[model samples]
Target: MLRLYESSGRKISARIALGWEPSEVFECNLLEEDRCPVSIQGNEINAAFGAYEIKSYYLRK
Candidate 1:
């Protein structure tokens, strides 16, 4: 899991990939708390090439 946060400490988002599944997509509100259960919203993302494919998102300030 990759954690992303805003500079003002207001919002956060995490990215994680489990295997190569073309049918999977996700999104969610950025959460700072580690112990709390985080809920993520699902969005459309695409990946090509098989095996250990890396997916990344960029956070803009």
Candidate 2:
């Protein structure tokens, strides 16, 4: 699980390195009740967070 938080109202780029490749990746919605598929490249995950937004991702191997 990866959680990202931004206090300021600014867009930010995030890169997370996973030691091992994951078979699947899911992006959790604000409520964390819904999930959607996310693309993964190499051994890392790249994402952009909007202003004053919080994002969470779940990786499954």
Candidate 3:
């Protein structure tokens, strides 16, 4: 599980490196209601975050 937090009061872009390629990626939420699929390019995940936003991702090999 990888968690990202944007504490800055501005939108930001990020690139997360997992080192290894993941076969599947899912976006995790607090409610755990549904597992939203996330796109992975190579061994990295690129995302944009809003101010004070928090995001969690689950990667599976």
- Position 57, candidate 3: lDDT: 88
Candidate 3, overall lDDT? 0.88
Clashing pairs in 3: none
2 versus 3: better TM-score goes to: 3
Q: Deviation in angstroms for 17 in model 3?
A: 1.0
Look at candidate 1 and tell me the lDDT of residue 5: 33
Ranking according to lDDT, highest score first: 3, 2, 1
lDDT digits (tens) for residues 1-61 of candidate 1: 3333334433333344434433332333244232333233343232232233233333221
Hey, what RMSD does candidate 2 come out at? Answer: 1.7
TM-scores for all candidates: the values are 0.20, 0.78, 0.87
Could you give candidate 3's per-residue lDDT for residues 1-61 as a string of tens digits?
A: 7888999889999999987999998998965547899899989999999999988888899
Q: Give the top-scoring candidate (TM-score).
A: 3
Deviating ranges (above 4 Å) for candidate 1: 8-34, 44-61
